[model samples]
Target: MRLAFNNFISIYQGLSREIWVLSVVSLINRIGAMVIPFLSIYLADAKGFTLAEIGWVMSSFGVGSLIGSWLGGKLTDKFGFYPIIIFSLFTSGIGLILLKELDTFYEICGGFFLVTLFTDILRPPIFVAIRQYSSEKNRTKSITLIRLAINLGFSAGPATGGLLIATWGYTSLFWVDGVSCILALLIFVLAIQPKKKIVEENDDSLEENKKSQSPYRDFPYLLFILSMVFFGVIFMQYFSTVPLFYKEVHELNEAVIGLLLSSNGFVIFLLEMPLIHWVEKQKKYSTMQIMMSSIVLVLLSYILLIVGHDLWVLFIGMMLLTLGEMLMFPLSNAEAMSRASGKYQGDYMALYTIAFSISHLVGHNLGMQSVNIFGYNYTWTFMIAGLLLCIVLLQLFQFSKKREELSQTAK
Candidate 1:
């Protein structure tokens, strides 16, 4: 027990004050993340939108997210991380507040798009800030710290949002979400410096960094980003398909589905840090290896679902899925950072963030389309094929990254 406690503490030690502040900001924003999770239901029940309308509204959010990430990356590169992040937070807060007044389908859709745009615009800057704040050794740990805060808030958000909706109604959710974003902005303004200046290295390093800035020029990194998109697509099924599966197959109610889904966040909050620390402490497994293991776990989780229809089986599958998420995301962030030069970190992270955005658009369609056309049993089988392809892509990415590093060093 003493050894275990020390190990957990070790994971958090030596992180910079800036990273801690960012994590706090993340926690604050996510705690009031009452809008998005319940947005579909709110539109359907409160606003009287048809299923097709809800889908269009949600797709608009995803499209806005993709553009927001790209725009944020460029802005962060030119103006630095602080301004873009602050602007995004403030924009999202104001947008969400305005969203409550919009009743028409088009108005609501536009409002939601703007809200998601700003919210996603905040992401790449956070990654850029993490790279700026942490040393090489603590890179993965820092990203994991932010993720820890996110999961912590995710675990709490829906439960509190549910209560707020019950007591004060859906508009309260938007108000609270907006207020939380502004509160996060206040924390940022008070605690963090307004600008992050890029530290200069030697001329050769500067040239290399500049060259790496354009992601389109880096073929290997592009392939790696593709792998990330695939990973994200498969992982997103947990959100898109798993709930529907539980409903249709097991006849689980909303309460049960919510409980089952929330467990993913709870388990990550409880165990992710310790698990990450333990993995990093081990010298044998590389970041790629850890990622591959995560992929395998996700694959197995889906396989579990394919075999069993019981609630316990669903719980087990979700547990595996949670563990896979904890292992994959921070490690992938670290890998992406490692491959990027300092000047291009924002662009690299932006492209990485876009993969998730793409998955948000694709995962649901993949799940629903497959299930509709082929049935649930075959849908899981199709996902297994996708996971296998991701494994191959990850392996190739690792090889390509190593080769690029060797070529750079030989110069």
Candidate 2:
């Protein structure tokens, strides 16, 4: 036991300081942001908003994300990841704090929009650093750890919020989010004081480090971004539609609902690192196909949830969602980074993050309008159609595998 423990410590010790810093930075950043899952409930229960108003308010963050993603990616390409991350974290803190004070619907929604925008705007830069800090040896592993931290934060944040809001009220929830974010920002500034600025490193002809010389040279990277964003609508449904279903069908209370929804995170925390490491050790192309397959399976689970709302059925569906997420996040990230030049790791990662960011916006905007017109059950139908559409896109991309292989010479 001690020998295994010591070896694990040794492996961790050998990771680059930048890698560790980025990992911890991701962990802290996610922990700070995790307070949001219950924001809809908080507004509905404590703020006295109607369902229609709450739906629009629920989407403020997505609206901000839509505007931020492309701009944020461009900023990372122009200035650097460090500046963007530091600025976004602090702004997220301020936004959360202000969310506590707003009373009117417009004021609250407007504040939430900026909060979501500023907070998520940092995603491109954060992901840029993550891909930058990986090696072939640990590329997928490192990102998986980062994803694990996110899920871990997800596991705790809303469950904790449920308890806190149940006793202390909702404004206090944003205050807690604000304080934690401020602390995260402080940690990022202190722990990751980058010794030098971001410039295209001259030396990276390494196996996984071939990078784009300029953002304009990133067309394939941009294609991968389109693929990622296309599927994001399916993923976003877990946050928006699934929660609504739990409330409407199960009639579950805040804490119980939080616990059920959070079980996915629990599954992720226990199993993801080993699973990612194992999957990446396989042939890379096949590995991604498997990950993509998992996503299809996850989408199918939503179909199941849409059909059945019983507790056990929901448990099975949630389990599928968690497992599929454990595979999807890291592998997709690594694959996206793999296609780019060494110098444009940040640029490539930013595009990938842009896909996710835009998905939130597109999904929610569609979701809000769809719910008003067709009702909530068909929201899952839209999600299913989006997932199936992406599956078709995957098929289209798979046929180009030979082209991808032929282009590997570019590295």
Model 2 ranges off by over 4 Å: 1-14, 41-50, 166-168, 195-223, 243-259, 299-314, 340-347, 364-385, 398-401, 404-411
Which regions in candidate 1 have their CA more than 4 angstroms from the true location?
Answer: 1-7, 200-212
lDDT, candidate 2, at 402: 48
The local distance difference test score of model 2 is: 0.71
Q: What TM-score quantifies how close candidate 1 is to the native fold?
A: 0.94
Best by TM-score: 1
TM-score of each candidate structure, all chains considered together: 0.94, 0.80
Q: For candidate 2, lDDT tens digit of each residue in 1-411?
A: 999677544444435577776666666666666457777777777789999998788677667776676666777767778888888888888888887778899998899888877887787787777656656678777777777777777666766777876898776777888887788778778887654644343443433434435545544444456667877767877777667767877787778777777687777776787676567557755865786687788887878877885788888888888777787778787777665454454566666776777777677566757877888778778777777777666665655654655676574
Q: Taking the tens digit of each residue's C-alpha lDDT, what string does model 1 give over 263-356?
A: 9887888888778878888998777888889988999999999998688988999998898899999998887776556667678778888988
Clashing pairs in 1: none
